[model samples]
Target: MVNTSFALSSTTRRRLSLVIGAYTVVVFATIVALGVLSATASDHAPRDAWVHAIIVAVFAILLPMRLRAASRGSLAGLRAIGIISGVLFMVNVVESTLSMFPVWMRTEMIVIALLMLVSIGLVVRERL
Candidate 1:
């Protein structure tokens, strides 16, 4: 049997790691920005935005790394982050929907959350 399976080369892995790390940094920055912007709005504005920002930060940190690990045939990281990220995303969506934000932002969040779910499904199919 000619085992034709291939793996990502070390150089490719390292490059991808760098890009993913940069993406993570950008996501974290957005979270911080949201929190800071929230503080200037109104009484409930900061609270809503900050809460939304923090949960999103949690999702932002976990999901990408977990998905990366899953793609390499490891279920451990995926299991750890999948449930929590999914829950946080859903909670954020629901809370944001109920909060003082405009309907458009709430809709955007729902779309983001759905995309996260799709990623989770891909991870499960690929690595588990």
Candidate 2:
């Protein structure tokens, strides 16, 4: 059975936005927290801080645009969200296992990864 329908239900769209919104908030909070922690400690690496900064920036831009596109029934937006979520999920999982970050930050990576997983599932279900 081939399903060509790509329209996501309003409920699904709302849930997707909420999940992404939460993930974005958490990512921003983690970066802010890292900044404060780094300010007080000499152990944090500049490279790691820059990596997190870039992640936060990407999420900030994508969140709004993707949500708007999805609401408008854009398949490209849904596809992009799915691919981005899958890629970020892997990135977060790898980050969570790294030794240099604080345990709390690593835990936060896991949380973000879970959100990405949910996002992947949502988009896949809609597309299929």
Candidate 3:
């Protein structure tokens, strides 16, 4: 059910935005780092890293638009952000477990997952 009456406070909304922005920065950084490592890393397939980076890049780009909508009190926007955050969390969890990337990258993935989890929680709890 859509909770039309639910509205995020400015502080809460800013927190959500911060989470989203931080996630985006981390994601782009991951992509850049992956690209740099892909040049010399022989332990993992460059194709896999590139694919993951591309997918995350798309999500990172989409977030600001969704945040704008949510900030405007659009329920669909809020739901979209929550859903994206949850999906990214799961993706990062899986990535963190893979042996394909270096240990440091995997650790970064763990950090990304945690951040996404926080974002998801913020969106979900506010809606609730």
Order the candidate numbers by TM-score, best to worst.
Answer: 2, 3, 1
Cα lDDT tens digits, model 1, 101-127, are 645446646655665565445434443
Candidate 3 residues 1-128, lDDT tens each?
Answer: 75653465798789988887887888788777776766776454366767877888898899889888878878888889889888988988988788776677678678878888888888878877
**Residue pair clashes in candidate 1:** none
Candidate 3 wrong stretches, greater than 4 Å: 1-6, 40-45
List lDDT for all candidates, in order: 0.55, 0.78, 0.80
Which is the better candidate, 1 or 2, if ranked by lDDT? 2
TM per model?
Answer: 0.56, 0.86, 0.85
lDDT of 2 at 27: 78
- Pull out the clashing pairs in model 2: none
Clash total of candidate 2: 0
Candidate 1 regions off by >4 Å?
1-44, 102-104
Give the per-residue lDDT of model 2 (tens digit) for 25-92: 88787677767766786465355755865775587578669877877877777878888899888988
